[model samples]
Target chain A: MLSPEGREQIKYKARKFIFGSKDTEGVGKLAAVYLLLISIGFVYLYPVLYMISKSFMNLNDLLDTSINWIPSQMYLENYKQAFQSMDYWKTFRDSVVIAGIPTLINVVICAIVGYGFARYDFKGKKLCIGLLLFSFILPPQATMMPTYVFYTDIGLINSIKAFIVPAILGQGLKSQIFILIFFNFFRQIPKVLIEAAKIDGAGHFKIFRRIALPSAAPAILVVFLFSIVWYWNESYLTQLYVVGAFTSNAGGYHWSSLIVSLKNFENSYNTARSVAGSGMVDINESIEMAGTMLSILPLLIMYLVLQKQFVESVDRTGITGE
Target chain B: MKNGRKTKPGQLERRENAIGYLFILPWLIGILVLVLWPMVQSFGYSLNKIRLLPQGMAKLYVGFENYSQIFLKDPDFIMGLESYLLETLIAVPVIVAFSLIIAMLLNQKISCRGIFRMIFFLPIIIASGPVMQQLADQEAASIPMMNVTMIEQLLDEYLPHVLAVSITSVFSNMITLLWYSGVQILIFLAALQKIDTSLYEAAKMDGGSKWECFWKITLPTVKPMILLNVVYTVIFMSNNEQNALIVLIYDTMLSATGGYGYASAMAWLYSVIESAIVIFFAVLIMGRKDVYERRARKYQRELKREKRLEKKIRKRGERNERNYAKQKAKQQRKGANKKSA
Candidate 1:
């Protein structure tokens, strides 16, 4: 019924169709897998990407669009300006002083208390442990005003003393108890090690230092890292106490924070820096964006570098595990 | 109950007591000086209307007036409580459902599971501390997408409250909740993996469909985790102070008025409510038992027989359909040949 040319054409078409099926199916699966991964990854990474983008833009540019992930031209000067704006050196110095002293105190006090909780049987052991958990749950806000009043009553307000005293006592009243880490890590050490040291005539202090403290180094490290981050990021309390005190001392301007400072900057910069009737400040956006970038840089850098330990602690201990 | 009987302490035990007290002295001293006395004073302050100077001067103690003002008079406190309830109501179920599905997906034998886990955990890192500000900004920007035309068209007519709820606090909080789902996922992952593979193998051997196996085997095994996730998500949602105390406290602090005392009262009240909610649901879930039954002998036999019948019917139906189609085609070919002849 068919000529040789027609028959050959039909066979050729059939062979071509059959060969394409395998490659097409493989490519289809790969595409779907790629699409799925990319979408989920994008959603997860979007915020960090946004932070990086905003950090580079000038303040005005930040508000000009919904988002500017890629700036047409990068302005490297925002970083320079943020350093100057925050009085970066002074803030950094003050931050280190405030955060460091408390952390040292927290480590020492928490290590001892945690050891007591872990190793010894005392009269109020159950009650004391219960109270510690109670303190943990007590929202810091509930206590902040009283704590403030208490500090003022004792002449501890507006100084590094204000931050350090609570921290030193393991009573900072933040959600975290540095002692929890002490409790966990201490509990893990073979009780016999401490018992053996005690029986050999090492007193409590000697045993805690020579045996328990060294055994709990990882927890100590974890707590130190957490405490430093806590003290550094404590902008609210710092703002509440420090901002009012410093502004009042200056006598004229009631300087608000950058959260509030942004509005002032816009008004001042627009009026002074704008070239006749341009109606917008030349670099206002740049400054604001740069300010936000600068304020958060120390935190971001520290987080990026130490996220491994930070996450490791949470993964291992479940945070609330006794 | 037995406190009346006083036992004599041995010398070694007394010595241990003295050593223990000495070791914990710094914390005791700190708590006395810093936490306790101030907390007591604040409770008194909550009862009074105070003027705050940099110095410790309390002008007057008006009994329970500050507490009354927050509980009886302040509309914002009430509104804040309602908003918190609304957020918890909307966000908790979504988080439970979303996380369980995600845990299931992660449990699949897929490449790059670690990457998915890390991505899921990224939000948690953002949830705490200074990193919150950037996360907050991104959350704000993502707000408008909740009002997408297609989503609106589908759900708007049916669930009008969804729009209002989703746009404001609910959407951002859901995003925050999504990050926190990592912990739940990890917990669920542990639960899922612990599930006896033999149960699944037995189901497969009996020719159970994937859907049936999931409902009959997987759901029952992970029931406890599902309950845990729900309770944790609810607690986390309530503890977000934005819906509770942040705005009130911040405004008061900035204004430098007597708002701190009232805010403290509100915080105290809200925490009580939150703890009550968590405890209530926790008790409810742990007491329930319908979810825990293993397969009965009769049920197992019935399931196996049904699955075999389904398989047999499917094979026969496919063969019959193919044979009928081939017969129809052959008849068409014969008709064409008759026409040609």
Candidate 2:
């Protein structure tokens, strides 16, 4: 019933809505973006998903080639075995302490040092700053042996002090990066703000505490989270320094972390398997996946809870622009 | 640094400097004792054959024997170093490039961007060495649907063998490599978000296509960030506990055959190589100036050149006048001599 001209106009409008015009985004582009993001996002989360699904599959389901993702049934035995083998409660306690105390010290010390570099001029500030960045590139492996010896000499080899001492001294895990982040962040604080505070007869420490530190919530949060994560993830150093993996220094000190236990899970599980009777099932992929899941479970929960803040922190962190 | 002038230190300036030092005193001492002193001690350790006594370490100096042993004698280190270098060379670029692409994509006007970002960044919270190892063992590090072998074969047909092998290795563990780029994506996103929307509009007004604007504007603005990401990627790849060389060093440190001395030497060598990689990337990316910076420099140079030309012309005119005066004086003197004659 429509005229030919009216039909053509309607067709053109529909095409424009889909294909887009010069000044507006079309549905086509949006669809393409979503498609790309969705595919890549799937690839990104594929490992975690695979880990989760595999952890629930029983031996029969895992051996079946027909089963790709979905398991025949939920299996909680993997978690139970992994829990016992890892000594979950004890190792979890150790991980918390090992990652917690140093993170706190690192945040405080790095902030103070970063603030000093940002706001002050000293005789050798440039040299100090250069060294600060240079340290980031210098591998911790380069200093591992001597540092181990030094810790041994100072009676910190097999204790939590091994981690805390370096942290208190502003040399914790990735502390250089944290300091740089703080430096970049605090630099953006207008000079006038500090000047205004100073004119009120406040001391330098008072000014930093009351003025500069208060507005730095975003950087502090980012550093705190990053520090905790890095410390928690660090198993090699933890074993070498605090856990006394070599057994020579394990006389009075008994420290183990969750990640370290996961790393040595096979050996520990074998040991546990021998101690238990032959009734115990042989270790399989499901149980191994379950152990991996348990190790990362805490961090995954933390991320889920604090994700909004964590994602937004990068924007205000000025990590790239500076 | 103020106004590019060096002012004399007043009493207040000196006092402020002291206060600044006080604020940073903990870090300064920390670096000196924990970092610098250990560095010196490690170098000393590398020169010796150390024995771990129950009470203390006994040292017998061996000069560069440990170094020579690493270069000439140790086969495990050489092979590990080769594979490490090969994998890292392939991995860093792939990670950084993927991160930049994702950053640009996320920068676009999209729905549920927060969820997408969280998905991308979830690995950072969980990707410890042990966890990664476990996932890798379960064959979870690769996409189930991806025919990695097809890609490997495709690469082999086109690329050199060693290169193809490393690329295939990268493909095999592609998810882990991609996971490593979470912070990098955040960094690039921050930079991309800071870019003014008005600039893109201006480019559009100038008849620039989206591709051209991306190449000409977006890239140039984020050039510094590329270098930052490269350096970060290099450091992360080298220092990650998953690295075989680090594990090798740790094992060497504890092994009965190779004592702390040999391990120290190996670590120093590895650290040197690591620093070289970082420097190489830094120089490769940092060598070029920004497009805007180059243009500004060109304008400044042109202005300086014009002033220099004006000054040269003025000087030439004055010199010509002086010559002319001298010639006129000479002619006048010649005429006076003729009159005297």
Evaluated with TM-score, which candidate comes out highest? 2
Docking class for candidate 1: incorrect
TM-score for chain B considered on its own, for each of the candidates: 0.65, 0.89
Model 1 per-residue lDDT tens digits across residues A182-231: 77677778878878997899977888889988777677777777677655
**What are the per-residue Cα lDDT tens digits for candidate 2 across A1-322?**
9999999999999888887776888898789889999999999889888989999999999899999899988889999999988889999998999999999999899889999999998889999999998888899988888888788878998889999999988899999999998998889999999999889999899999999899888999999999999999998889888898775763685999999999999999989989887755899999999999999999999999999887777789887664
Report lDDT (Cα) of residue B212, candidate 2. Answer: 88
In candidate 1, how many Å is residue B99 off? 5.8
Against the native complex, each candidate's DockQ, computed on alpha carbons, is 0.21, 0.78
Name the TM-score of chain A in model 2. 0.93
- Which lDDT tens digits does candidate 1 get at residues B164-195? 65544445454555665655776566567777
